[model samples]
Target: MKINPLLVGLFLISPVFILLISYPGFSVVDSSEVFQVFKFTFHQALVSSLLATVFGALAGLSLSSIFDSKKYSFVESLYYAPSFVPVLFVVFSCLNIGNLWQISFKGFWGIVVIHVLINVGLVGALYSKILIHRLSLMNRLSLVQGLGVWRYLRKIVFAHTKKDLLFLFAVVFIFCFTSFSIPLIIGGVNSTTIELLIYEKLVVLGEVEQALSLALLQLLFLVFFLGLINFTQAKEKAITTSWNPFFKNKIFLLVPIFSFIVLFVGLWLSASFSLGWFTELALLPTLIKSLGLALFCGYSIFLFFQFIFSILPHSTFEFFMSVYSSPSTVLIGLALVVVSSVWWQGRWLVLLFGYVLLYVPVLFKMFVQNFLSSLKPALKVSRAMSANYWLRFKMITFPLSYSLCLFLGFLTAIWVLGDYALASLLLEADSTIALVAKNLLRSYRLDQASFVITIIIFCEFIIYLLYKGLAYVGGQKY
Candidate 1:
């Protein structure tokens, strides 16, 4: 539980990555070009995630409808298959399909379609499930009263739908806004995203200061928007997610069937009806690489969870509130002095640590809340027993939480391995499989791009299977 001095320095210096990356002068940056560029980036991503969410909702609705319960289960499983597949795979699949339709995958609209198709499955799946559950519950009452489905939705469905729709749009905006791989791969010079620009300035141009500045600038903008969303949401009435979803409508029913036709057509154009994709020997190496990365990432995430849980028993707000408020730059200075005295020289490790801090809020919120839910009752029981912290947590908490924690770790890693921002920090390493995949696109080798994407899809399916396994196991434990 002891804090390492080396980690201390890295956490302190994290923000400088952004400050260092900006162009030399804010004086000149004020020209309309900067504002225009920023506006373009924001609008494109906003539009994309929104559309993706609508499609995602439809995607979920489509599968959840039409099919009977038994067959719907199968369709539901396939409906969500896209979220795991890498964005590049989606792009290449688009490219292959485009050749037949004469559709070009090179512009803003084209990129949006790929992002929507690939990621909407999650929004749809979750949204649909919630809707179906509610609908089933509402149906019981409606059937008794002889009220119609529309009446139920207008009263109940609308409320639930609003929350999910808002949430889905917010998330879609963030993903598209921050996305690197998909935009960079399919976007020609005409379609450069802020991430690509950051990469160009920092990695390609070696303008670390400018890149850091831009990165920081983008972060600030995101904080501002996020703050506004929070403020607006706070002003509104609080609506809890109702664990119910209904989808007996005709429009919702035919959606997944139509989507399947679209998906099938894309797959057909992509694979070109060749069983070669099924038999290719090249898939093995890429698969091995993806599996290795997923495993390491998964394990690392679990270790991190274990480390945090052991070190801090208090709420994360209580734990980080003290440290986060302090200017990290000052802390880094102290950490640097301590490291020097200790003869440590892992500056790169320090950078990695900083990124972890930057990304911690999202992942932490997702897992820590889950962790705490299980801890509350145990802590209370310990209170009754007059047991000390370690005694109660050791016997009750750790064992009970480790499996779910492992499952959390696995899901987090799968998410991280595909995480563009996290992977961006470590892209220089030989183990940068995502970077290697990006490089495949760089070479403009469509066939090679095809290979990388095929492998990505396979790896995702494995991860998805593992996640479902974890979900099943976790469900049983509860």
Candidate 2:
């Protein structure tokens, strides 16, 4: 029997709707408190998005100039390394760096700093690729027209990229607005964001109604913004060319270099590098469980994407999925908590369900839909030839997307392995290494937390190698 991807999507997202409809009337929350949290959330998101865009644009410009050749493509991955790992690692890296410099990272500015660090690479990589594709032809035109650098940038470059930058700003703003783990860990009391506020109400104060209301409010804002902005990548054919002279300024190189130095150096300085404590804590079981959970989550996401891919080129479904954002982590955790209570032994199942729901939209937006979009022309051609769905997928889709799927699965596993926010609410105990590390950090054991983070990094490397091996083996079969 054929399954509808849209129906599957609806079922996955039903938890949010379930909470929204089942909300038992309105409960009064402090108006001042809600407003205060909202203000901070908006303020921080604005600052972070703005700073990240500026730095990211500069880094992108620099990268486009320096790594213009195909041989330098692997080095480009360094710019994105900070973004692919879980936020926990970024937070610790920033905190350790702050300690090294004797600076405090415990308030509004700290949150902004960490957010910028996490997003700059992503924004940079995107902007760089866009510039390469969109500006290559324009660069030649500008030079032939004898356009000065500043004038060309203002009149041509900025004009072309303004919409793209706005869209990126909105994307970054949304991420910062809905941020959870970062604020939960480093945000001082005065800097609590709306997400953290919801967590406090639900988990700390047991104010279920208020938490649900806040979550709904957050969702409304996100939907409103999403409705306003339609982000479409430029489809202009990439012009093969030499370096754009305007981006040849070597000073812009500092942006990515500085980012890399801070993350790696901070990790090096902070990690205790001792396995004695790791063994003493008897955490091997927890580590193994976490790895297993991560592997499961990764495989589930891969299969889900495969299902989505099989039913390709559904415009309405793709549009909706592209704009869809999951409800707050706290809200999802609440829904699953109630469900788990009824199912009793289904804690793992519920946990996985939540992970899928939260991550599917993200992966779809970032990778799946893009991959599907690229296959549309071929899909149409296959259909016109009266090709079967399975045949088309086998001959065209799977071969093209296999590597990306493996990479996405690997990334998902790493993220799940490092996740603690949702697991904290659902699990009865600290069953994962991430949760244990979080607890240690909360208890002010920085060294121990850093040590655990190092272990996570090692595990991530091992998992990455395993995925690479699987890819090699699978490739041999094809």
Candidate number of the best lDDT: 2
> Over the stretch 1-478, how does candidate 1's per-residue lDDT look in tens digits?
3454335334534445334332234322333655666766787787788877776776655554544676766666656556544555556667767877797877688778766666566667666764664455554465577666667656755555665566556656766777677777677777877677767765676655555556656766665655444333211222232323344543543443444455545644544223464345344554465566666656666666665555444543433422222122222222333334344465434433433454344455323533554466666777689876577557776666677567656665555454444444443432444545566566775555455455555566677678678767766764
TM-score of every model?
Answer: 0.71, 0.92
Give the TM-score (vs. native) of candidate 2. Answer: 0.92
**Regions of candidate 2 where Cα sits further than 4 Å from its true position:** 1-3, 21-23, 67-71, 143-146, 231-246, 470-478
Candidate 2: tens digits of C-alpha lDDT, residues 1-478: 3556688768767878777666766577899999999999999999999998889888877777774465336446767777777778888888888988898888999999889888887787777776776688887788788898799879877888886777677778888999999998899879899999899999999888999989888988886776566554433444454556556665665676677678878888887977688787678999999999999998888777777777777777877775677788888998888888889698988899889887777666555643564678787898899888788888877776777778778888988999998899899556899898888888898888888888888898888889889899878866
Q: Please give the clash total of every predicted structure, in order.
A: 24, 0
lDDT of 2 at 50: 99
Task: Go through the candidates in order and give each one's C-alpha lDDT.
Answer: 0.55, 0.80
Model 1 regions more than 4 Å off: 1-30, 58-76, 129-143, 231-246, 250-290, 306-407, 415-433, 463-478
RMSD of each: 6.7, 2.6
